[model samples]
Target: MTAETDLIKLYSQRILALAADMPLAERLEAPMASVKKRAPLCGSTVTVDLDVEDGRISRFGQDVKACALGQASAALMGQNILGRTQAEVEAARDALKAMLKDGGPPPGAPFAGYDVLEPARDYKNRHASIMLALEATSQAMAEAQQADCA
Candidate 1:
């Protein structure tokens, strides 16, 4: 397909809708862990705050300032974040990375929402932005896990 067609597919209606519907899209007060990631090429950014209990996220929040692709990714993560264990969140992030970088299948159920982003694989410049949400979530989960151990 042509670049225009690919672009159209990348920014489909579903992606736009998801971009606007991120849950818990705010910053938590006194969060146990927080992470912010920026896409150097586009300057898109996403911040995540988390509280984990018993290895699962008990609370989650975020501020996403990015292009539609990034927002859609954040929305997918936000929609499924609560109660996810750190391992689960990290696995989702890894799966997303593989999908984008290695042309692998979309993340599994729950994170299956990420399937819509498959068209993004051809746009390397957008990869980091697309990854920011899950990247921050995984990092925040790690920090929360460490804090819990302390």
Candidate 2:
């Protein structure tokens, strides 16, 4: 069917592979910070847990419930989230948003794996799901940092 073909085109083999083997798929035994993000439109959700050290992510994990696009996005974010600062994660999140909504460039390095999602630009509805992991990660990092300050 046309719709199926279109989906296959959008969710390519690479995307499926990333989704199938998401990094940091397990939860951290003890997280310094945690955040959950849900895509209201699709009901997809990602729960992120992490610990920060020296202003960078020291450990990371996630529970992802979403379509292939969301899973792939989470996989990419999880793969590289460790060692990243909240500012870096937020920058990647912003870049991804621009890429999806404004036809901008892919996110910078460390999160460059997000480039694989370029095809998803046409599917505006899926944007939130794809960005959920980064959103949760950024928030968790900020929370951890704030707690450290407090």
Candidate 3:
């Protein structure tokens, strides 16, 4: 197979593997905060839910229906965000956006885990899918924090 084809296959397989490992129940639970993002060009949508207490995430979930990249991104977000604090999640979100937009460096230790998505940087269209969950999570956390203060 050509190198390009192989890369596509590899990324696709990785996404599938991540998706397969996600538990449905974890993605369906009610969230203290929720946000939705859609990639209109691809008709990909991701809805992320979060429950936070004392600045730490107490619960996390999402309902996603989209391409492999979107699904995999959601799954990865679910796996990694379970115990992280609001500040940590925000850092990761910023890092993820920078990475996708300019291939900029990651946002330090709290967001280093986002490196798993580095392989996706070269895949342009996949960028939107990958960012969907991150954006939703960040927005949800922000709104949740605001509500807590009100």
The candidate that wins on TM-score is 1
State the lDDT of candidate 1 residue by residue for 9-128, as single tens digits.
Answer: 999999999998879998999999999999999999999999998888999999999999999999998888898987788889999999999999888977877999999998999999
lDDT of 3 at 33: 82
Ranking by lDDT: 2, 1, 3
Residue 9 local lDDT, model 3? 64
- Tens digits of per-residue lDDT, candidate 3, 79-102, equal 777777777777777777788788
- Preferred candidate (lDDT higher): 2 or 3: 2
TM-score of 1: 0.96
lDDT of 3: 0.73
Tens digits of lDDT, candidate 2, 27-108 = 8887999899999999999999999999999989899999999999999988888899878998999999999999999998
lDDT of all the models against the reference? 0.91, 0.92, 0.73
TM-score of 3: 0.80
Colliding pairs, model 3 = none
Query: Can you give the lDDT of residue 1 in candidate 3?
Result: 71
